[model samples]
Target: MISRLSRELSPHLTYHSLYHTRDDVLPAAARLGRASGLNEDEYLALTTAALFHDTGFIDTYEDHEAGSIAIARAALPDFDYSPAQIDRIADLIAATRMPQRPADPLQELLCDADLDLLGRDDFMRLNRALLKEVRHYSHRPVPDDTWMRDQLRFIEEHRFFSPAARTLRAAGESHNRALMRAALASTNGANHAAGGLA
Candidate 1:
């Protein structure tokens, strides 16, 4: 699945590339799950959710979580997952959508995995890559201040749900949040100086 995604997915996916999914998110999920003390079955379900969470992006740019669920339904049975297991995976995938609402420990782990970069060291570099990705798909450039403000809002509003995720990520996320807040403040100040706030 990941191999096909690496080859067939849009090249414009600067941040959502195979490296993002295969290399980063998958391992991140594993680490978080272990920290969360998930049993073998729960880990399998969560890992599978991580695997297929972004599969919808192959078909559509927005609202890919729904598409990911459809793809999972069709594919999971072949892999010997039961109906209940597939449903759980779908729930976890969908939980990664904006306004992320994870109902269970596993779902919480998946959410943390999805936003692992928010707490990671390379947040700015990857954020810029995501901006490049947006430009590639939309053919429009996001203004620097607007991007910084939006990133600040998102980082400020989001939180890691599980204890393990919070333990693993809170410090890094706080550091990034402070950086984003500083950047946003500077941008706002520059805008006011230019009288753009008017």
Candidate 2:
């Protein structure tokens, strides 16, 4: 699956690439699953969900969660995953959709793992990767101020659902929020200065 993703995902998907799912979210899910006391089966389900979550991006970017679910449904059966297990995996993947309404502990863990980078020190780096992806899909350059504002708003509104995620990432998220605010202020000031000179 990782190899397929690396081969097939669009070159423009800088942030949503195979690396993001396989390298970043996968590890985070494992860590959070252990921290959250998932049993062996639940841990398997969560890890499976994490790997398949962003895979929809390979086919389409809009409503990619649906694509991810479809891929899982098609693929998991061959791996001897039970229908019930597939359903749970589907639910976890769906929970990662925007506005991130996780219905249970496992869902919460998957959702948190999906956005774990948001609360890490590498937030800015991954944030820029996403910015680039957005610009690519939108077919235009997003203004720096606009990007910063959107990021700040998202960070402010976002919350980690699982206790483990909150304990691990909340402080880092706060730090990133402050960085976004400062960056936004500086960008606005620079823009204002440029306008004044004009």
Candidate 3:
């Protein structure tokens, strides 16, 4: 899976690359899973979901969760995953869809793990990468002011579903929010200055 992602994921995916799944989301799922007291089966399902969550990006960018689920459904049976287990894994992967409405505990854990970076110190670095990726796919530049405002709004609106994520990431999320606000103000000021000169 890792090799497939490394080879097949589009170069345009700076943020959603294989590195994101392997380096960020997978580890985060394990960390949060341990903290949340997941049983062995639950942990295995959650980790599997995390591993395949963004793999849809290998074939398609939009609505990739569906792609992920299809891949998981096809692949898990080969690994001896039971039908019910594959269904659970599929549900967990689907829970990560945007406007993330996780209806169960494992789903919550997977959702939180998918977005763990929002509360981490590296939020801006990854945020920038996402912006770049978006620009590449959208084929247009996102103005600094607009992008900053959108990011601030997203952070302000986002909530971690798992207790472990809330405990570990809430403060970091707040800090990142403040940083985003400051950056937005700075960007607005710069744009205003440029307009005044014009």
Root-mean-square deviation per candidate: 2.4, 0.8, 0.7
Structural similarity to truth (TM-score) of each candidate: 0.91, 0.98, 0.98
Q: Cα lDDT of all candidates, in order?
A: 0.89, 0.94, 0.94
- Rank order (by lDDT, best first): 2, 3, 1
Candidate 2, superposed: residue stretches over 4 Å from native? none
Tens-digit per-residue lDDT, 1-198, candidate 2: 898898999999999998899889999999999998889999999999999999899899999999999999999999999999999999999999998889899999999999999899999999999999999899887998999998899999999999999999999999999999999999999999999999
Ranking of all candidate structures by their TM-score, best first = 3, 2, 1
Error of 3 at 37 (Å): 0.6
Specify the highest-lDDT model's number: 2
**Can you write out model 3's per-residue Cα lDDT over 49-157, one digit (the tens) per residue?**
9999998998898999999999999998999999999999999999999989999999999999999999999999999999999989888888878899999999999
Off by over 4 Å in 1: 185-198
In Å, residue 182's CA in model 2 sits off its true spot by 0.7
**Between prediction 2 and prediction 3, which has the larger lDDT?**
2
Q: Write one digit per residue (lDDT tens) for candidate 1, span 118-188.
A: 89899988999998898788878788899898889899998899888899889999999998888888988
Clashes found in each candidate (C-alpha, N, C closer than 3 A): 0, 0, 0
Pairs that collide, model 3: none
